[model samples]
Target chain A: MPALILFWILAIVCIGAALTMVTAANPVRSALSLVVCFLALAVYYVTLSAQFIGAVQVVVYAGAVMVLFLFVIMLLNLGAPVTSSTKGSNQNTAAVALGAILLLVLFISGIFFEIPGKAVSPATAQAQGTVKAVGLTLYNPHLPWLFPFEATSLLLLVAVVGAIVMTRRQV
Target chain B: MLTGLVAYWDNLRDGIYRLFIFPEYWHGIRLPALVPYVALAGIFAFTLGILPMLIWIERVVIGLMQDRTGPNRLGPRGLLQPPADVLKLFFKEDIQPGSIDVRLYYLAPFISMLVALSAGAVIPLQTVTFRNVHGGLYTVPVTPGNVNIGLLFMLAASSLGVYGIILAGWSSNNKYSLLGGLRASAQIISYELAMGLSLLCVVLLAGSVQLDHIVNAQNTLPFGIHWLPSFLKGSIFSWYWLQSLIVPVVIYTVAMIAETNRAPFDLPEAESELVAGFHTEYTSMKFATFFAGEYVNMLMICGLNASVFWGGWLPPFNCFPFTFIPGFVWYILKVMMGIFFYTWLRATLPRLRYDALMNLGWKRMLPLALVWLFLLAGYSLVRTATAPHITPTAVVTVAHVAPGR
Candidate 1:
């Protein structure tokens, strides 16, 4: 019963922060709201027993990525209160439509999905979320993940080279 | 005084319970849910308790280094100076400049203090081995958190510390504040990679991510070389700093200095350049909290490094009368050594140029850390393959004696 209550509270905070991220006028406020959403999502991950993923989410997204977002927002010389200009009406309409679709998908998935009814045993779930468990799965060739990791590495290398080449000539 | 404090706390707890209508027992059981939080609060109080002492040490050391008497007027050898400083700060007015981001302005220093305090939650001060009144041994680790992911959690929390400085700089909206924030974000993020990699070397040598396992791994000669004569054995040669060529320790030391933004790596808050760096515009208790966070972080990093490099809570050798002393004394001694190292570096070294600092972090420290990690991994792997019997002891029995090492 307590778990149910916590899940609801976290879910509310997550959704509320996500809404605030979209609604906040200042770019920095939006970024701060995004950090709140990320933190709430991390707590949600922990409640579901994905402890390693939860830590990684906070460490990576909220700690590293959002800080960079806030930095960029602060650097942009847009220190004043920001309102969406008339030129971005189309973008605003598209965002609203996409959000509506997302909400619809959530409503449909809530009914169709098993939705935690057949929960894994606590022992197995805890084991599944542990550092060793995640490490083994990620590095295990039998898990079909090694190829994806190699591909990502190769893609990053290419991006680095491309960035250097582009930066060599004045844009 | 200790007993008085205990009695006062018990009275307060009971008074709150009565006021809130909380039952003393629910179905013949006391509340277990509040135990961990209460323990955590104690840990926080302990972490913050040393701030005044730290300030006194830093000021005195720096003064002696520069050939000046440090704050001798406050009390005996300036013992009462920090409290006086604290009082002055509390009485000062908080200044909020116009054209500032008020929300983030208020949020910055609190983030600094919170991250600083929480980062040490996983560090083990002493270990399991106290006998109960029944003469049965009961073992409990003396730390706020002892999770399997202890090291990673510390790394993550330290990484989060960048945000506080960044936000403080940005919200102030001053040119110097912005520069300081940007410098801090850049410097901290650059150095953290090297720090993480250096710590990875310790994890590899111990074959576990847990800090307790790491300490236990250092209790014997390197690779458990039992052939050492009775004259030369345990703790001294067993420490990873000696075993792994001390490269990790060297890299860790430099990275730690940079990570804390102390002098030499303190380009972010350079007084000559940024006018106090990230906290340039902060005043009153907000400023005091930021000041407290820097010293607290220094202690946390020092405690962590002591555990990783030195044998934490372990006497120098088993053959000595050093075993008579409590183990936490050794841990405190090692941490103090680390703090002394910080002061020594600050006194001896001049601040690096911006490019030099970045180059040291990225080109020098990061590559060195990577090389050390690889070397340690290969050495440990070879040792395991050659003689599986000599692997470092990484486990502890729950009912074992009080002194872990």
Candidate 2:
């Protein structure tokens, strides 16, 4: 019951921050709100007993990613109020339309889809979320996950190389 | 008399267990629920109480290094100087720069202080064992948060600390502040990689991410050599600093120094260049908050180093004299040694050139950490593969049929 209460509170905060991120005119404020949203989502992950995911979320998104975003915003001097040149761009209308469609899709899926696995007990979830359990699941030779995991890492390596190449060309 | 004193100590320990560990209900209210809050308050008091003394120690140590008498006034050799300085800061005029981001400027120092303190939550100072009602002994780590993911939590919190500096720089509307903040963010991000990698070496050796388990893993014979003298078992020799062959510890120390923006790695607040860096525009209590936050961060990181690399609360030897002292005292001593190391470096070394700092972090430390990580992984793999395995005896069992069949 206490977990349920905490979940609801975090849900509200997460959604509120997401909305603020969308509406905030200043880029820095928007980035900061996005960080708040990410943090709230991390808490939600923790409440779901996925502690590893929650920590990684904070470290990757709220910590590293958002800091870079703020750096770009500051370097570009984009914190100033939006000017009249883009006042009637109709971007907001397009965003609203796309958001409505996305919400509809989410609602339809939530109502119609039945997940394949049985709902895990809190104890099982906690056990599954441990570093050992996650590592075994990811790297076990018999499991299908190993290939995809290695592939994802390879993709990241490629991305790093690509970034280096792009920057070196400019230099 | 010694037995009576021991019994009294045991009673006090049990009382503490009741209060913090297996909290009992009182007046129909669950007491366990208050443990986190109580622990948080304790951490706050402990860190804040030590902040003044830390400042004084730093001054004295630096003065000693520079061949001068430090703080010889205001309560015995300038011992009262830190508190007086804090009081003065509290009473001084709070200055607000014109055309600054008012809300964020006010928010920055609090963010810095809060993040620094929150990182202290997962650090286990000591472990205690107590007898339960059933007369069975249970050991619990005495920490604010003993979560399985404690190390990761610390990393995450330290990463978040960049925001405070970045925001302080951007909201201050000062060029120097902006430059300082930028340097801090980049430097921290770079060093964090090496720090995390070095810590991963410990985690790899311990096979656990929890700090308590990491410390416990070190309480063994050095290199698992049974031939060593009994006193050497579970001593400093077994600690990660030596166990990991000194490389990871060295890398972690350098990375931690950079992470905290200390001297020799303090490009962010290079007063000679950026004029106090990110907090250039901050004044009075706000500046004091930043100052206090920096010290607290130093303590937190040092505490981590102690626990992760220096055998934590474990005594230096498995002997009567060393064992007589409590674990928390050793913990504090190790942490203080870390602080002294910081002051020593500050007094001994000049600040690194900006490019030199970047090169050291990216080119030197990062690669070294990565190579060491691979080496340790390979070593552990080989060790596991070569270790003797016990063979099980064969057994035969008959399948039982249903009774009717």
TM-score of each: 0.86, 0.89
Alpha-carbon runs more than 4 Å astray in model 1: A75-83, A87-91, A115-118, A160-171, B1-42, B130-138, B229-234, B392-405
Give one digit per residue, the lDDT tens place, for model 1 in B187-276: 887788899898888887776777877787787765566787542344667787887678889998999998889988888889998888
lDDT of 2 by residue, B208-253 (tens): 7888888888888887776787768779999999988899999999
lDDT of 2 by residue, A1-171 (tens): 998898889888888988888778888888888998999999888888889899999999988889988887777777786765756689867978998999999999899878788887899999878666676566666668889998999999899789778868553
DockQ values of all predictions: 0.30, 0.45
Weakest ten-residue segment in model 2 chain A by summed lDDT: A131-140
What's the lDDT for residue A82 in model 2?
Answer: 79
Q: For model 1, how big is the iRMS in angstroms? A: 8.1
Q: Give the number of the best model, judged by DockQ.
A: 2
Number of the top TM-score candidate:
2
Which lDDT values do the candidates have, in the order given?
0.79, 0.84
User: Which pairs, if any, clash in model 2?
Assistant: B71-B77, B71-B78
* Model 2 lDDT, full chain set: 0.84
